[model samples]
Target: MLPIRECVEQTSGYIPGEQPRTNDFIKLNTNENPYPPPLEIFEGLQQELTKVRLYPDPVSTQLRKAAAKVFGVSSVNILAGNGSDDILNIAVRTFVNPGETVTFLDLTYSLYETIARVHGASVIKIPTDNRFAINQPIICPKAKLIFIASPNPPVGKHLNRDYLEETCERATGIVLIDEAYADFSDENHLDFLNKYDNVIISRTMSKSYSIAGMRVGFGIASIPIIEQMNKVKDSYNLDRIAQLLGTNAFNFQEYFKVIWQKVRQTRSHLIESLKALDFLVFDSDSNFVFASSQWIPASELYKKLKERKILVRYFENPRIKDYVRISVGTDQEIARLLEVINEIKSGQEFT
Candidate 1:
């Protein structure tokens, strides 16, 4: 047998949440949008089906142009990928030489550490403050590339604009902000790109645009930085269907807004309901809420909810062990979840 690299041998890979195949459960483990993609996406994909025999555009020009228009940047400033995960991989490869350092928030998407290891870079986990805020000064100054998920996962806490600006100003290498949930939040650092060449904001269609299955994601950065990534990316990183559908989705902004409004409304309702039940809910700007309680162990609560055909995410990490991250679903789904939680509180398990 051939020998593997030491880094490859020791790496523990990224584990995405369990995506159950059965429809029996009310799935909330992944922070996927509850709404479906706009009708235009389906229509666009249907029209493109005839073209599958041809290879997708290697440059993804049309999708990049659409994204550029939506984000108020030039096409040269945008680069499309199979998914934001692919873009992350590109960033690691583009910026960090082998044996260099890549920094990520201690309890972020969890994939960052794994991605760094795969790229043969040393990983540094920068611990957030007690409130789960990214401590910029401590993280930015040392790393070759820093990946921060604004409105970060699990905790759903966002890094404010001033903090982001400060981090970019002080950082030695690229500062990548994973804005997977930015559509759900009012604060965004898009404008910061005008001032900082090192800043890159990456977004996915999975969360807000309701196209996780489509695997469309794009990165916005200074044109120079984008050009570098473009050089390193696979020519056909995004398929023909994804390009067509993603462009159509971006074109129909109003339709996307309608679904986002619903998700925000459901998110608010879920947060308030959780608080009313005496769960300690974090201030969430994302599509999900982080709620914790001592009344029941989070693992037990997760199991109970599972028995009732409701699934939510429970992290085994000690900092978040007592909490379960629940995605905002339809109003009726949320109502049912609350009902189940209440029943569980009353010692009636709904299995």
Candidate 2:
């Protein structure tokens, strides 16, 4: 066997949420939209089938143009990727030198640190203010790149805008905002791209457009930054079928808006329902709820829920060990999950 680098050998890989490939589980561990995307996406697949024999456009041109029309930015300012994770990897490679520091909020996105490690860059894992209602900016003065999840993960709350404004004014390095869940949130940091040349706002069609299977994400940045990142990506990063589906989904904002509003309404109901059960539910700005309780241990609930074939995310990281993150599923799915919880409370035993 070939020898591996010490960093790669010792590092723990990023673990995505469980994906059981069966219909039996009420799956909500991953933050995916429960609604189907617009009908055009499926209809376009038949036409896209004809062009599979050829290579995809090295750079996704038409898709970027459609994205430009939707984002109200020039095509030059947008850079498409296989997924936002690809953009994160490209950002680290583009901005951070081999030994330079890449900083991000700890507990926000585990993949950020994993990608930094892959690039052989040093990582500075900063803490959220208080874990739950935490809001703070990256303070690593020497960092070459900073990735901020606007509506942070696990906790599912928006960052304090004042800190972001200060970051734009104070930070000397690149600022990348992960807006993967922003479509579900009422807040966004897109305006920062115009105000700061160092800022890059990344968006994904996975959650909002219900196209996670397509793997298309794009970044909003200063033209020069996008251009540099463009030079770092694979020639054919996004496939032809992805380009067609992504473009159609990007253009059909009305469909997304309707589905998103439904999810938001369901989110409010789920939060209240959980709170009424005496769980400590955090105020969510994203499409999931972060809740814990002194009465029932999250781990036990997670195990019991899994046994019953209902899946919600449980992070083993000590900081949030007591909390479980539940994705916003369809109204019927959420209702079923709540019913199971009531059953668990009534008689099911917990460790």
Candidate 3:
């Protein structure tokens, strides 16, 4: 019998949200932005395709420089990846030894646990409070690396700035703050890099930037940390098209602003509507809302939505079993969802 590693044998890998091939459904299950990339991004990719015969710049220097300007960091301090997920894998490979521990929030992104397991590292899941506040104290002191997702997944609650600072101060291991949704939020911890050598902040172009299919994400950290991650990352992790498209997206900042404003507006309106329906909605700084319905179980609601060609995320885990995470779609799409909820409520008898 071919022998598999114990970690590989014991762990079930990360399962991404369903992407139904059918075009009829409104896809709100994955936290994808409901906008298209600016015209410039498409043009940039088209022009760059002429050069695809040659290998892309292995270092992705142009993209890194553009990202540096936007992030207010030196180019040396930024490292681009195929997506933020790639950077997470690279960080684990670079920092975590086989028997060491990697820690992240208990109910946060499910991918981190799988990444840790794949790297043959122990995982410590620190449970969040009822309000989805990360309990930083529970992280093992001897952990080799920690990954924290702000505006955490399934709940959409952010870690306070002070709490993040305290975590960095107390942790002996490297702390990676995954700020994939930072653009939707009012604040970010990028400045923490200047103060903490052990801190790294990862961002993605997938959410607020409306370029999920483009596969561009990056990390901002001290030069040394970036250097180590670079060593572990694949030489051609980012293709020429992604580099060109991402750089062009950064160039057209006004285009991003317009789309982001629309997303936030839709988010606010949806939150109000959900509240009107008597659902408990968490305060979100991301492109999605985490909500629980008193009248219906989340599983039942998810099925109902699916039947109507609308898809939202529902986790079976205890912490999030009662909730459904709904992504903010275009105004018409959201209105349609609200209408369905009202119909469901009207038809059902009281418990």
Candidate 4:
């Protein structure tokens, strides 16, 4: 047998949102954008299909420049990735040496923990206050890097300005702010770059741009930091097709603006509907809602919903075992979900 590291052998690994191969189920498990991206994204992918013979720009120069324009940062300060997952992986590998400590919030992105374990880095998890609020006074000055997701998943709460400011002020290492869902939220920390050289903000086209399939993301930081991470990235991480589609989709911000507006509207309606049905919905700043119910255990609901061919996320993690996270989908899909819930409550639901 291969000499796998103990961490690799023992760990369950990060379980990503399920991608059922069939289209029979209503997929609210992953927080994927329900709508397709602008027609140009697909058209450009088609146009770029013939260019696969040539190597993609290893540094993603054109994508970086376009992202810099969209983000209002210098191209020198930007680094593109296959996805924010790649960006996160780069941050961990570039910043933290084995035996160093990496810190992030508890009940946060689980991928951070998995990455830390892989690198043999000590992880200090600061448990969130009330499970969604930052557990303040993060005192881990020994940390080599910290990852915080704005509008954190499963809970979808944004970190306040003071918490973000204090986290940057306290940490001695790279402070990575994952803004994967920032387009749906009112809070943004990109401006923190002006105040702290240690700060890096990572953004993705997955959520708001409706381009999750393209696997495009980027990070903005000081030129030195960007350059260092760029060095560790796999050659041609962002393939030519991804580069073309991401650049083209990012250029059309107007279409995504409308898409986000509708998604936000649907989010609001989903919250209201869930509350009306006696579900305890958390205040969310992302495209999904984290909610619990007194009527049934989340595990049971998860199983029953699956039986009905409607999939939402239910974590088996002890802290949030009572809750299920539902991604906001098309209005019609949400309506159907609500109807199913009603029938279930009436003792006549669950197909």
- After TM-score superposition, what is the CA distance of residue 249 in candidate 1 from its true location, in Å? 0.5
Q: Estimate, for each residue in 233-333, the C-alpha lDDT of model 4 and write its tens digit.
A: 89889989888888888788888889888999999999999999889998888999998877888898888888899999999898899999999999999
The residue ranges of model 2 lying beyond 4 angstroms of the native Cα positions read: 1-4, 133-136, 348-351
Could you tell me the lDDT of residue 112 within candidate 1?
A: 90
Residue-level lDDT tens digits of model 3 in 58-98 = 98999999999999999999989989999899999999988
RMSD of 2: 2.3
**Distance from true location, Cα of 213 in model 1, Å:** 0.3
Residue range 140-241, candidate 1, lDDT tens digits: 465899998988987787876677778788889999999999898787889989999999999999888888888999889998899899989987898888
Kindly list the per-residue Cα lDDT of model 2 for residues 83-155, writing each as its tens digit: 8998998898899877788888866889998888867778888776656434555577888998889788877
- Please, what is the TM-score per model? 0.95, 0.96, 0.96, 0.96
Q: Give candidate 4's whole-model lDDT.
A: 0.87
In every candidate, how many clashes are there? 0, 0, 0, 0
Number of clashes found in candidate 4:
0
For each candidate, the alpha-carbon lDDT, in order, equals 0.86, 0.86, 0.87, 0.87
